[model samples]
Structure formats: C-alpha cells, structure tokens
Target: MELQQMRYVVAVAETNSFTRAAERCMVVQSALSHQIARLERELGARLFERTSRRVRLTPAGAAFLPAARQCLDAAERAAAEVAAAVGEVRGRLNVGLIPTVAAVDIPSALRDFRRAYPNVRIGLRVGASEELVEQVREGAVEVAFLGLPTTSRPHGVAAHELAHDRLVAVVAPGHPLAGETAVDLHRLSFEVFVDLPAGTAGRVQSDLAFSAAGLSRDVAFEVTNADFLARLVGQGLGIAMLPAAYVRQLSGVTTIEVTDAPARVEYVIWSRAGRTPAATAFLALLDVPAT
Candidate 1:
C-alpha cells in the first residue's frame, strides 16, 4: 500500500478518534474518512469499530499499527535528512596540500576558513604533487592545493592561479654559501642538489628553472617530497631550491634568492569538478593574500 495510506492508518490508530486524526493529518474529516474507507476496502479488512461515543481500532488495525507508524516515521526522517544534506552548508570536506613541506600562509588561510565555516568539517593530507593530483582525478578527495597546472588538466578539472611565488635556494646555516647575498647559477652548477622526486610538480618546476639558467644541477639526492628534502638539507645532505613559502617559514633552513634568475612559480590548483559548497568555500580563502 502507499505510504500515505500507512500514514492515515497510523495517525487514526494513535488518536483512536476520527476527528482528532483528521486534525493531526491537517485534512478535513470527510477526506480522512474517505481515505480510511478506501484503505480498508483495499486491505479487505475492517480496521475501526465506530460507536456513538468513541472510535476504537479492531484487532486487525491494532496488529498493523506498529508497522504503519514505523513506515511514516521513516519517510518523514528521510525527507528531513536529505534536505539538510543538500541545502545546508554543514558537511565534511577533504583537502589535499603539497605547498612545500612546511607552509606558513597556507596554514593561516586554513585557520581563517575553519573559523568562517565552523560546521564544515576539515581534514588535510600531505603528499607529493603527483599523488595529490592522482587523488583528485580519482575522486578520492574533494579538493587539493597541489602545484600549478598538473601534468594534464582533464576536461572537468579547472584550476586557478592563486599566488605567484618563486623557488629559492635552501642552504645549511654553516655552509659557505650561507654568507652570500644570493646564489647564482654559475655558483650552483657544481653544488650538490637535494631534489624533489622525478614525477612531482615541484620537480617539473625545478627542472625548468635550472634549465632556464643554462645550468645542469649536480643532482645528489632525489626524494619523494619537499619535507624530506628540507630535513635532508638540515643535515647538510645538499642545498635545494624550494618554494619560498616552505623555505622561509620552516626552521633549520635558510633561503637565499637566486641571482639574475627570471623564474616564477604559482600555486595553481583546486578541485574544480564535483566541488561541494564546503570545498568551494574553503578554496575562497586562497583568493585572499597568503597572510
């Protein structure tokens, strides 16, 4: 039988008075009586015993009362939940980041986003640019702050160029280059390099920057991510060219500008396809300056 029929049965059973049940159902008593009559006819069973002073349920009505109440309650609850899920801004969002190993401004932006959208649950995952990109393309996560222009921007994936920063050299505090105002390509050609992994966005940018200076780096160590590269640099594994955000904000490393270099980097990505309102709101924080 229809859910509406079950609701009528349940409402009549609860109130045990046709007049009260009609009021509860927000319909006229005549309409309620007509529907009940149709229900009983369809079920081929008598449901109510009508009397001058009161209305009471028959044995069959009592037997069906529990099932009818459960069906009506479930229908009402499902409607409420579905509306809240889609119409309300309170939900969970998963965002991925590869903004260097230790980021300053990006973290600050997240603080602002959290305070603004308190109901929107937030989670962060750190991975290489390659992994972040893959996670987004596979719909494993809702949003990611991966490095600019992934290897490919599939049709549905749209990205924005949020901030423009540069790669700087990170050297040990006691290294000879530590005292220099800036490191030049001519000076770095022979210096040992701690590089980002071969298939990551940072690596692509680093290779291009070095190539533009007409210098082939003396590659020493290649790691999966920038955080690993930074720690290695702290141990004097080698100097590295890292995004300014990570290098300048992180301890145990010193950043020096590269002399006479005309290179720039952009943090240019957000999950465009299938973005929920919560994810979209979080991404808006990226628009404000990285303070």
Candidate 2:
C-alpha cells in the first residue's frame, strides 16, 4: 500500500472511527472508506470491525499499527534529511577555469576556498576560455573565470567582474627589447610574436586590440598556454604579451608594459540554474571585496 494509505490506516486505528479519521486526515469519509477498503482488499484481511454505533480495529489492524507508524516516521525523517542537505553548506561544487587562470590567478583563491568550504567537495576542470564558458552555460560547472569581451554572456548566464588585469610584454632578459620601460606597437613589428591559436577568446582579445590600434600584428608562433609562453620568453624563443600580474609573479621572465592596450577583465560566470550553498559560498570566496 502507499504511504498515505498506511497513514490513513493508522489514523483510523487510533481514532476507532472512519468518520473521525477522515475528518482528521482532511479527506471526505467516503474517500477514506474507499482507501481503507482498497488497502484491506490488497492485504486480504479485515482492518476494522464496523458496528451500528461505533468502530474498532480487527486483530490484523492491531498487528499492522506499529509498521504503519514506523513507515510514517521514517518518511518524515528521510524528507528532513534531504532538505537539510540542500540547505546546509555541503555538497559537490563543480567549478571551471581557463588553464591560464588555474596557473596564474587561482592558486591562492583555491586554497582559501577549500579552507572556507572544508565540507564541500570541490572539482576543478581546466580548459580554454571558450570551453569554460560553454561548460558554465550547460550546467556542467557552477562557476568560471574568463577574460572578457563577451558582448553577450549567453542566455540565462550571470557574470561578475573580478579584476582589470594589465597586459605586459614577456621576454627573456637577453632579448633586445627587454630593457625598455614600455614599447609602442611599432616595436612589436620587429619581434617574433607568440600567438594564442585562432578562435580562442585570448586570441580574439589580442586581435581586437591590435585592430583598434590600426596595426595588423603578425603571429610568429601559435600556442594555447600562457604559462608556456612565459617559459618560452624566459628561454629566449620570442617576445610576447601576457597578463602582467600573472606573468610577473614568475621568475626569469621580464614583464614590460605594452602601450595603450585595453585592460583584460576576469569575469566569474554562473547560469540560471540556481546555485547551491556550496557553490554560492565558494563564489563568495572567489569574490574580491570592493573598496
């Protein structure tokens, strides 16, 4: 029988009258009678003894009472547990990050998030910015960090601007252009530029900036990873552009300002499928409090 049927059985047994039980259960007496009749039919036994003036339980009804009560108690407790899990600060919190962010920016933020959400299971996936954005939109990830130019943040998605990351030119110390305070766009024409492969967000940002400057910058090498770019610069392969704050923090790479380039902003993204407490709490951790 159904849980509600067991509940109806218990109510009738305790009150010893179907009319009283149905009223207490907020159902019509006839409906309650039908439910009990169906339940008894299924059980192949009598659950109550009816009389002209009153009603009482049969031996079978008395025998079934404890099971019905325990079932109701167990169901209530299970429902409460599920609610508690949802409302409390504990669950798997899936997050996405671009590889550049995972290496250059998120190390400290990740450590702090883990400490803040010790009970939360944090899963981190690193990929290109384009992949990260798609993952957030599809609900494969709860939050992400990406460099913006996202004219549209896709349908049902929300964004939070984190920081304006300055772009710097990374070069090996021995490169001819390394000692300058900053280089104008023309100096770049003399250098071998490491390109972020076509179709990536980083590549788009780089192209848009150069195009705005009325210069067609050439790509000497195309690579996906900025951390690797830093290493290439350190090893004297080419002079390239990268996020100043991130690349400067690494040793053996000289970061020089690139004149008049737009600042890169990191955005934290989430979509319409509401965030869990674990995800919300982690978002707070990633948020840099405003001045």
Best by lDDT: 2
lDDT (Cα, tens digit) per residue for candidate 1, span 1-291: 788778777777788888898999899999888888898998899889999888889999888787776676456545544645777555666777774634335678778888887777777888766677677775556676655422233234555555556667888888788888887777877889998777576777767666777778877899876677788898898998876665665789778898754333344344554455666666666652221
lDDT by residue (tens digit), candidate 2, 171-257: 888888778988876677567788678788777776777777788776878887777867777888787777666674678977788
For candidate 1, give the lDDT: 0.70
Worst 10 residues of 1 by lDDT: 148-157
Which stretches of candidate 2 lie above 4 Å from their native place?
A: 1-87, 102-105, 150-156, 287-291
243 in model 1: Cα distance from truth in Å? Answer: 1.9
TM-score against truth, every candidate: 0.61, 0.65
Q: For residue 156, give model 1's deviation from the true position in Å.
A: 4.7
Flag clash pairs in model 2. Answer: none
Candidate 1 residues lying further than 4 Å off, grouped into runs, are 1-87, 99-104, 149-156, 260-264, 285-291
